[model samples]
Target: MAEQLEPETILREISDLEGRIEELRQAANMPVPDLRATLDAALVELELALTALRTMGVDQANAAGRSATAETERRVLRTVFQDAPVPLFLLDRDAGVRRVNKQAAAMLGTSPGYVSGKQFIAFCDLPARAALRSQLAAVVRTGRRRRTEVRFLGREHPVDAMVTMARVWIRGEPDPMIVVAAGATAVPDGPADDERPTRTATPAAGTAGGAAREAAPLSDDRDDEVMAALVHRMDVLATASELLLDEPVFNENVAVRRCARLLTAEMTEWVFIDLTPPRAGPASAGGTGAPGAAGHEANGDLRRVVVMGQPDEHGEETVHSLEQLAPEPGTLPHTVFTTRQSALRPHVEDLDLLGVCADGQPACVKMGATSVLCVPVEDGDRCIGTITLASRGEHGPLDLLDLGVAQRLGRLLALVIRASRLYQRRDEIAVSLQASLLPQRLPQIPGVEVAGLYRAATHGIEVGGDFYDVFPAAGGGWGMVLGDVCGKGQEAAAVTAAARHGVRALSGWKSDPAEVLSMVNQALLDEERFVTAVMAGLTVGGEGMKATLASAGHPPAIVIRPDGMVRYASSGGVPLGLFEDFEVGTQVIELAAGDTLFLHSDGVLDACDMSRRQFGQERLLEVLAGHAAAPLQEMLNAVEQRLIDYCDGDLRDDVSMLAVRRQPTPLN
Candidate 1:
């Protein structure tokens, strides 16, 4: 049992109760009929109780009875607060939620714990947010009660209601908090849903200045709705950027798919992306696709690239069926793509706005979409594609806010697509340029089997500088030249072209390998670049083939016999294009039947594995010896495969190899 209250204390308690009842009466005049009635009945009962208390004055009532009456009044107030008919939020001065009733949590489609500590205004839609912030601050500063309309962004859908806010001072806190009461807006008798006037939100403006303002008058709550929608859109763009840019290489197809999946998660129930083929001409500098603007149609029709829906049992089947529906001309998606503009239809009266599905059912009807928004994917003034967004009844219909967001997203995706295509074109050009630098075919020399291979390093987009050539030499002999320019890309390719052609031309009359290499060095000296090369002059005799090899700071040539015998031939010399009198390493060897010679660039020896271990000369020798008994081309293939496998397919430089084998039986 609690201690008895003094007469003075009892009087103070009566005064507090009377003040609370009066406040309740003032709040009861709200627009909600059910809440007003409840408050009115509670006010009457409270007045009756106060009258009885007054009748039993401090002189008549004992201290213990006064204590019991105070306790009973507290219980009634607690009951009223917890079981209020409408949603209520208790917020600190900063508008941070301190508590939310069950109705409030239900309105947010979340648990009370999730709603607590969050900004109370964040729940309101964008347009309403700024106004709510001002209202909340005004109420806190002035201690005045206020009412305003708000559109709450519920997890499932949006809820529109009128909210009343009042300042509330708690016992332990120095500053007062705010108490917000929200009631559902009552609708007067009206026409059926089908008969209701269709309200279509205007698409975003084309100019920057126009984009800053709303086309239609924004209701107090609508502003908050717009802000919330904008925030959601910005988040989507940030995530899409991470997803698309994180790839080792940007793929347009993968980007669109990822974007579609992301939209289904938080923004919409269904997403469709359609793209036009890349144009041959320069992208058009067309209009902003504002309403009434002429369409900028691409050469090709729009092809459906992605389709996604919210997670459900039938989602996959629905996606697959809808994938068969392409956007024909005059359809919403096609029109948006052609016009480079956006379209927002809140109440989609024309079911065939999107083309029909295979079953002849209207696409929007099958997807259960009440509203749709389509925006063009534009790069600069040219429209590249279209993104169509829809939602089921779980979310509110797409409106002007959604149209603005979709348009911005479409523009973002267009930039990504443009970048991806540009990279692809660059790679293609590199490939074609690199191919043009190499020999189309190696000349067939009787009594000799010659094969060469060139593989570019896989790490970069630029062309490599490794080159090899086989050409006719004096006295019915063959000349082979393999060289590596110091760098890559066009600069190195230019030097490579000069060196390969110089050697082939010089070897025509200069049969001696040393003389041919020395002249080649002088020819490249003006290039002010470095090139390592090994040239071999082979003359077929009635007995066997005599080979003269000259090295210019190049990798040593490997000589192999049929019985797995391996030896190296190297004449250490400075690389070409460095010195006018650089020494040319020269070696002479005779190749009998079933003997082969191998020449390669330094790339094979420099290849590194994941552990950064190099495939050195010792490994190259072992590889050659292991495959010595194989045919010429097969042996080269085996060596190349071993080099790639040793480095786990990561070559540090371009690999080029030339192999010459003296056949056991001479060519007919």
Candidate 2:
């Protein structure tokens, strides 16, 4: 039975037990008996228990003190944040608005509660939102403050502000919250904020907004005079550019003179245009022909285009045919041409004036010229020509505006000149290619009247890939071939030639239309090009003409009867070069006296008008029905004329057509 005792009682008993044990051990003189070890261990255990109880009491007191202190601090922080004057926002890691102070909500034109959980960037002006979001993200990562001036506001005129971002820790969050604060807002380029731009109106600084304050007045009368001169120069340049660019660009020399004449009479007393030939390289940006190549090919050599002078007494400009002189180095005109830049001799009153004009001499001495501006005519990277403008007494020294206008005129002149050259070259090639490739003559189909007409596209000058041929085949009958390659240029041309000759070679003595087309298709497969074709074998006799037609992705042919009945002969198959071995279907048509057979390429129905509406197959049938009784030649003419009217001369593709009609039995 253990004694139940209070702490004081236990201590007394343990003290008495210890004294008894020690006394017994001393009487027995047994080296202070082993009972002391057990008593000492018990004493240590009792001391540990007392220390834990005292520590628990101290911890309870400190917890209560800390809770009161934390509550007071939280209340103080909330009060300060709620009353702050400037706009403020508390943002979470994603920049979501966790809290917004009253001023911030009002400034943003929204209620505080409504803004919670919304993105902070949404309140900023559209143009300023991007920068604001970047700055906010940076502050969150670095845990530092950042500031930037950008536009703000959702609906009204954008308000410019110096936005500040700070990282701060809020209660219950492990990471710091971003505090978005802003300084006073101001309008950009307004009366209050001189640095901001006004909308649309270009100011002295070339911004959208006007100056913050009114701009300082122009310095003096000379500035006013300069403006007046610039106004007059701009008007002349604009008129000249419009006139030169109107309609088709004329001769290069004529174009240069048009520009020269304006500045000669109004701005400069004399204008000297010396055209250096285009560099003999691969090709100018404006052309595809080699130098000296026929058509628009520039001669690839330098020459003087024009030298015109304006005498004070003479009202109009006079063309000068003076002998060309060797130009010395370092002259204004030579320097501009060599450097591909412009040269201005502001006050050439006493400056050496030999190389300023073409032929290494003063151009308008008779006009009493004292100033000169020389600008190089540049086409892309190469300097192609030089424009020399000499100022006489009446016109004052050239200003920046005058020089700028001259530089611009020089560039426009260069472009038009190069374009004109290319246009000429393209025309010559079109005529030559047409003459060589198209059939020169077609044989008469014994008892039938046959005729075909072809027209090139109205787009850019490109060779037509549309081709046709009528040749005698075996059995005294004739076979006709018509088709269009997929694209234009030399590639399509090669395929066109192959299809024509292939049909003739395979149809030596009345061959199958499908077999002829299959052989041609095999030859074209390796080229990776597509072709649409229609091959017809026709035999004319006393009864009428029998025709066998095969198509490879081409439009079906049409037959018109004497009574105005229209019918289509459709043979559908994949286009040539698509599959190595594919079946081609054929349509056999029986033609009677007074019946007209029509074959055509897609270009006929695919012709596009200015409005881009296609001259569709339905409309073509209507035209054919109307001219059903007309002669074969007349019918072809009518179809061509109707197509022209529908397309308004704005052709989108090449058109090819063939019409054959059996002559009616003599006066039945």
Candidate 3:
């Protein structure tokens, strides 16, 4: 359909139009030409001249009895040759160019016609000419593709090109013609020609200064292209870094998913990330058990975490790989992970996917994948996972250049993944130390029901200083203690644990609440590790319970009557672990049936809302008055939820709440 009208046809029509215009000029006695319209028409005519030349060539080559389909195929091939990324040339069996693409013409500093019918080796530097010819000869003889790097001399200097040769058959020719493809790679400027390195392939990886292709001093234009590509890749890495940095929590799965989203934007059309689970070990403290490098031994199972691709979000790009088994040996991800290297399958087929398909993931046949690449993600020195890539866009199969891009991204993800695991491990260790310091479950006390609740600040990443314990006293009574250490983190949590443990240990010798505080305060000699606590020694009676309380710089206890009246108990003293000779103070109270006593940390009264207003004691007491008759556990739950509602973000400090209620006599 792009076969344009012949230039001669356009010229004849212009001639006929000029004759008509001349007749009009003579009849009207007008000397001025329709110059404006004529000039515009000439401009249009000039633009079509190139197409006219192409159309003329097409007409000459289009033999009679050729079907329309064959003509269309010729047009498609012509279009591809004109716009392809690399130089392409069709040569005779002797390596003389028969037809050359526009890219090849550009390289020769001439038009397509000027480049045709020339020996292909003539463009190469003298040193490479012989080697180039032999490779071409072998490819033509064996009917296989041959790859080599050649330095082709340009008008200004030489350009390094990765050249591939194969035999291509044309319908009218008896012998297959040679098809040569060349991908240009930039070479940095070297010392004035005398110091130039020998033109031979360097490294087999990256396009820049790599063994996969020979090197030569390049022009400034070539240098610019290479520099721009390096910058582009750096930009991709920077973008991925910014995305991960945006999150407060450097979660492992979140990092992988974000990487998949970013890579799908450019790196790969589809990405399948398979992460190996952390090796099994005892949690250091309170961890979610994500393994760190110290526990990097995996059972060799990689669970697919993210699947993303093009055109559609749900279809083709999606994989239900959670139902699949671990990657088996010889599969794409497995081979890459085990070998600790990348694998590029330039062309993929259903037969190559027998193991992949059986593993609950959609096969290449379903996703329409044309090529695959697998790169392993490393954490520290161990490979943590493999990122399998599937590409199906115009970018074609994965090349050495593409592999470089994937490798850089994998390295970035590995660093972040390892850091996230370490952070979680440290957090868990702190939580475990804090947990072991407290009772596993509340001790049941006669005639009283107790419930306690605790929450660490800082999104559970750090241990809170809050602590609580319930244990039996020496004289057939029970003791309950709640305390909060100054500051937070591992150090503060250690002191809080020590304080709770000391109280439980000393409760065996002492039944007095004040004496328990006095002994624990002496043990906490670190001025840096002081605590404010409220201790209670309870003696249960037949119908009610009497509790003697000791306050060590903690908030006063509040009592809620069955009729909803609320009152604060006498609880005020110098906080323990600060002064060497501070007096231990105690307050006694007897609670009737259906009454409750509430003890709390200062985090409640000092908690700030969005408006920066503290939830003061009056408001807390007012709220307690309303929950006076609620069950002990229900009261504790409601109180916690209320505090959470008041804080806009995470709690600013650790919170601990303890409640003691005298259960009503059994109904008869």
Best by TM-score: 3
Cα lDDT for residue 210, model 3?
A: 26
Q: Candidate 1: which stretches are off by over 4 Å? A: 1-155, 158-233, 280-300, 310-317, 399-405, 666-668
Q: List TM-scores for all candidates, in order.
A: 0.63, 0.51, 0.64
* Candidate 3 steric clashes: 6
Clashes of each: 16, 10, 6
Query: What lDDT tens digits, residue by residue, belong to model 3 across residues 63-132?
Result: 4443454455455556776566567888887778898765676554445685576677656643334345
lDDT (CA) per prediction: 0.72, 0.64, 0.67
In terms of TM-score, how similar is model 2 to the real structure?
0.51
Q: Residues 1-668, candidate 1, lDDT per residue (tens digit)? A: 22234577557545744543543343232212234333443544454445445544334336466456545644553676656766778888777888887677766555678678777755664323434655665566445688877666554356667889987655546556788888766312322444312122222211111112212355665566556556666677788778877766667888888888877775777899998766543332122333213333346578898888853455666677789999998689988776676887644545578987776655765576655789998767567789999764335456666677678778778887877766666667778878877899888888788999999896776788899999998877889989899998878878988888889888889899789888888888888679999999998876578889999999989899988898899659889999997798999999988789899999989998889988898888888888887777787788789988988887779999999988777469
Task: Give the candidate number with the greatest lDDT.
Answer: 1
TM-score of 3: 0.64
Q: Give the higher-TM-score candidate: 2 or 3.
A: 3
Predicted structure 3: lDDT:
0.67
